[model samples]
Target: MSPVLLFAVSLDRAHLQLLRQRYYYATWKADGTRYMMLITREGCYLIDRKFTFRRVQLRFPRRGVQQGCFESHHLTLLDGEMIIDTVPETGEQKRRYLVYDLMMVNHQPKIKLPFHERWKLIDKEIIEPRTYDIKTNKYYRYDMEPFRVRKKDFWMLSAVGKVLNDFIPKLSHQADGLIFQGWDDPYIPHTHDGLLKWKYAHMNSVDFLFEIGEGNRQTMYLIDKGRNRKLEGAHVTFPDDQDPSNLSGKVIECSWNPKEQCWEFMRVRTDKPTPNGWHTYMKVMRSIEDNITQDIVLDEIAEIIRLPMYAERIKLETQALQHAARRR
Candidate 1:
């Protein structure tokens, strides 16, 4: 089935050069906030971490002063990812939404617009406008942080350096991965056309339904998407604060270690009841195995910059954007 929203494709040099995109922010693992909001929306829908939507109706406050007024605005409270950010120094956790995109606006779907235009729309229409009415603000409101982008200053970043140097120190949330998007192209729903997402090759992780092994070593497995095959293997690493022995028959995360030639342990995935199906497991494995590394990525950029032949399709478009931005 087609996904209900836009999704990112795994990072690749060809796609990056095609889009002429170099800047990216850390992908905050807001799995705890497994929630998606459809704003200025009359109907209801619940969005999961996977960006799947389930329609639901939620009650809202009725207008008192306006005669025969019907409430069209509904703040559909989704029960998906609940963000829990832990403070490293104070050991306190806070919830936040570092919005990556603006998919919709006041009854206007911005998915078809180019990203640079869509980003400007988001800033002007959503973030800049604020309501002072405390009572009304709570209901017809949203909690989100501004999503920013860098220009030439960030063009030389590596996927590895992006996560470690840019994301790790500045963020309290899980710096799970990196996402590259096209600024000159329209949003392609449920596909990786103009978008590319990736995690650290070594830390490319996946969750599985864990079981105890013969020697008390833990193993995990995935039920294939079609319910046909069971894909199982390897002892996984337990979380920093959990008892590994207690995790038998539960969900846990495992990372692919290319150097050690094994699947190493990462953490216990607590967000969902079960591990991802076989299809997803294979998808993640493929991403890790077929990863386009930081060095190759940077090399691609350097090639495009040095030689005109490397990025002919979108080089002019990118240059135009920079030129316009400078003039403004």
Candidate 2:
């Protein structure tokens, strides 16, 4: 079924009543607070007051609001994303969410509304004017293309990637993927057209403990384990040459292990010198990983082992050497 049709039919009478009873229009709320009302086959619904662009945390209150709306109004089908935020951040860029269109309201299909009107309601009823310094008085129109009715194509993949790349950096929080909706399509729940979300798999690098093997092994670094070993206090090394002076401090991204729950060493960054401290290393690693794009891949050997491995390996090798020395 069409997305709009699905959303409209899903709502039962009880669900609609809850939305109208609980939710106050966005304009009615205090500054810095926002509300979202979504309509689906189940009914009209409100998102948690805590929900925002930074975090989408929907909860029970929102469900109650939805039930209230369905019971009170004729609103039928309406399904779309909502966001509210106050004291937005600023610097390189400011962030804000744009509502594109409406599919249903009060059990009535509203996609037939001119695209312009749908946008107008979102601006007027939902987003507060001063919340993000958005000039709603200006013209905003829905310009995106609709989803494909047939088989997926190459263009679809490219579009998904492009959307993710464009927004992920600007968002204050983590962005996993992009959501696609047909420009002409109406909102639908549990259906193909009204919405499709695409998530991308990302790669990152970080420093981990490395330990090196000893005895009969000329050079093998491995994870550090507590032991009175021959090689103690040895600095971790990247396969590529880096300034030794900078080597003793800081961890760098090497690779991510989904199962191991640790990051492998990549290269000691000579350019970005870091100070010594586990907290500092963690902060740097997280920031760097967050900035990493899909283009970066972990392929180097040294990057595979973490920094801790180096310390553990050194301890083991040190003990092995001490044992050999005693034998002599």
Candidate 3:
């Protein structure tokens, strides 16, 4: 039998909600289209595409051993996130492609099942057995309330800054946002039904080389000094406000124009009232030092793990190192 290929669908939050309301079972496509899967008395049918199937095959080859277990049991109606993580030190990426919600078992849809039962099934079938070849990834079946709702909903608005600050030291990659999932809500298709994600917009700071505008241009373009004519695409500023004579030191916001396929200037963020301090420099230096330290620690752990005699000790040490890295 040909192996079944599982395709992941990526959608912004709003669109996901609409699909869940209208479809019973969604078929994720590589091209980002969601098709409803219908199981009739005769066979399995694709409602949107008008395709029929006598038997459906499922396979998970890479870190998908858990899904394979479900396939062995003839379970269906699965929903979950295709999660991937990037290692900060080596820049290696790892994926688990977790399946957290089981909507069907033996061709029966579990839509009417309460949230608690669905969560329990996930833990029993996927998480507890650890059937998947989970290297650097993990499967979670807990209530997702803390990550899906707005901070304000849980009186965490003020503490969000602190939480982010606390998370920064330990995180390998940049923190994007906080997700809040309801503890008691069953995993329904995206309907804003029981899940929410709050993302805090952050401004990225980068330095760019400046260039003078020529030939009926309105704004100056930042270019590389070495490559005389090539546009480097950066935010450029003039000393007009401060000294009007020196163009060497100024601040500006740079943005890319998708329509023009060129870099453009946004505006000086006047409301960026708090000037960056010496502490910011310290933080950057600390981050680099921490990265070096983590690399050394990982190298040590890898060496320890290679020794067959100390496998258990190596596992403990590796967990400790991971925890320490998160706290960094």
Candidate 4:
């Protein structure tokens, strides 16, 4: 089955009061490879971030092996994080899946259901029973979704404090930031409300269509989707190893450096073409203003996250549409 993809709002605390509207939330770390797991009675399918898919056929238990388990019912189309680990002892790499969401099950769509409701279904139907795969002689089970936190408990600075101070340090996976999912809202494809992501100040980056200037010039302009050339301050300054001149027309990530008062290079984004919208750029700027560092305190982090933002994005978007319409 084809999967419906959804995009989350890059988290800015500015519009956080939207959370006050009777919402439940969960925090998940963004890391490793992303894939959508599609399960059917016939077999299981793996879909990557690009929507490329490969099906894995279901096989019955071997002749001599006891009847193991049937996980077709428990498994569903899910958003997942895949981590490849190299065994320190065996010098072999193993793939692991961390299921983040349940979008469908039993030939039915669950994305329309409330976040909490869908989670309940997943926990009771799948997690309690433990879904497994019988590949050759090995038993494989995917990881559970991230922990769900009650809004009230999560709102307290102490809870967030521990995650930043203790929990995050213990994780071996690569996490650019924490994802805040809305419990009461339905999963909508593409960009919508109910999903929020938070990351470190330095992790705040924007993708842009850039070009190398004439010879010996170390600077380049980052162009928006609208072909709006971001000149002057819009020119990104990458690391020494990255030849800015050789990166013509490539999409790269750039973050604001508050200390340097300029946009600095983060990395190159290969997953998709085109850059984030103006709203995302604004959010990055706001994050830079917070001056958050790796050793930030919990309260300070909370204040930075709770601050309202992107409030004008909707209006700006509408205006952009109208402008385009006028041109038409």
Candidate 5:
């Protein structure tokens, strides 16, 4: 079977009620390249969104073990994104991998486990050991690793204000949107409504297969999950400064320009092998049409999640979810 990666659907006005339906873990959607880390007996590797794997010289230390001792973890797969952060004062850049999910550990599939449990395992098994080694100076050559590894933090929906106003402003990295992950859901492959992404109006964009027709006419096509492409009849125009020959056959990120009444190129999507599927395209369009903002979503959350009528129900549901996770 060909390996596939999961994609997040856009969160529109219709999906705002999800705030009350299920407990979600929220994180700032970092503008980074998606990749999965696979640990094997041989070494460590990073698998990109296109399923291309590249080996990196790194070792995982055994938790609670002596310094300089490393373990050959087998078939451990973790999902994350690689981000480049700039030092505000010095203008220096730092490349780091922020891990957000654990798929499999030591050949044991954790996809069946709820997100909360999976995160606990990630902390205890994957992160803590390496942290111990690094802190105790037992692990040398850490500087030789390709990038720094850190765990991505998630917050409750109520604390989203802090995420937007506090956490994001302090980070040296750029964040284009926000992510809402299902706290009780399993690791779902491919696209799932359980995972939601919200972005500002102008920041909303789609990845499409760019094409150049006769007479220098530019066109865009939508690519499906199976890597199938379909003509979408979108008028794409490139600036004179950008060579059409260079972008004709690659995936391009584009957004709708209401005033100009055409699709505008944002950038070339080198990280994405194919374009967004039909469902994703329609949802993105709807989000653009509705022009939803952070404040609107927050207002809806206050109505549905914090209303006096729903307080008891929300409490009960939270307790049940916790109990079920503990049983697992």
Candidate 6:
């Protein structure tokens, strides 16, 4: 069976109020291909959004007395994205899988657990053990592994500046926006309102299926599974190095240019099988017109936090964290 995936909704004015209602952990949204890693006795595999699985030539240590140095006896499922990063010292590019959430660990389902608890389990069980092995040279065939596994870091909403100014600059891969995940949210399979993705107004983009017409003219279509709706004002010109014919039937991202009054080609979305639907396209366009800045979002959050009504909620959240920490 395939693991159901959760999708993040676009951040808007309505989402701003959610910050006051509950605590959220924020991280940079990586511009990479999303995948679910399943570790079983048979083998370790990467499952894509399209429900395609690719077995990896790797193994996980049994961690305890077994110490079998093989894939775990219990099934483990993880959510993450695959990214290509540049190694600073060697200036060489390498593929890395950045895991963000845990679904099942040791065959025990964690989908019902709070996001904070699930993340903690992923760190203690999956990330730490592997890291310790690598550092101590325990020899789990590290040299034979195709890619490195990493835990994506999350921070409090107050640390948004640190993420944008400090963490992003140090990253070797591309990050498009900020992701806000509810601290107490359970793992909802699809379109979780508590999970939000926010990009800079100018950085907002939409994916469309590109088609070439007569006279080398081009048109863009939104592939919404049920229908291929043509998008107006989506005129595009490919880069000099890219061939239009080669890009036919491919999904391409485009950002609206206010001054130019047209959509500008951002890049080809090779990872996505289809373009976004009508709802997503309109939301992105509205976000662009609203032009909400990071400063504005921060200000809204600060204002909400100062209210007396949210005081008790903040206190309870703090206490919950403190209690969880003590238990750990």
Model 3, 107-202: lDDT tens digits are: 666766765467566555445433343332344432321111000112112233344446444543343344333334544543343343332222
**For model 5, where is the 10-residue window of minimal lDDT?**
61-70
lDDT scores for all predictions?
0.53, 0.32, 0.35, 0.57, 0.81, 0.81
The predicted structure with the larger lDDT, 2 or 3, is 3
Single out the weakest 10-residue window by summed lDDT for candidate 2: 24-33
Q: Which digits, one per residue and each the tens of the lDDT, describe model 1 over residues 86-122?
A: 8889988775433445566545567777766775654
TM-score of 2: 0.28
Residue pairs with backbone overlap in model 4: 13-307, 14-307, 14-308, 14-309, 15-309
Residues 180-299, model 5: lDDT tens digits? 888889888988787899987677888888878699877677856666566555786667798877898899988788888788888899988778777788999988888878788677
Per-candidate Cα RMSD to the true structure, in Å, reads 7.2, 25.6, 19.7, 12.7, 4.4, 3.3
TM-scores for the candidates: 0.62, 0.28, 0.33, 0.67, 0.89, 0.87
Candidate 6 Cα lDDT to native: 0.81
With a 3 Å backbone cut-off (N, CA, C), the pairs that clash in candidate 6 are none
Encode model 6's per-residue lDDT on 1-328: one tens digit a residue.
4459998877877777787788777899888999999998888999986688899976565565235353453589999999999989998999999999989987889999999899988777887667667666664568779998988888766567778878988999888889999988999997687898898766788899998878878888985657999987668766688788777889988877788778777888876778888878877776777777888877776676566655566677678989999999
Tell how far residue 271 is off in model 3, in angstroms.
Answer: 35
- Per-residue lDDT for 235-304 in model 2, tens only? 3334455443343334343544445544445554332222223432343344343442333211111232
Off by over 4 Å in 4: 1-4, 41-43, 54-75, 84-94, 125-158, 216-232, 290-297, 300-328
Better structure of 1 and 5 per lDDT: 5
Angstrom error at residue 27, model 2:
25
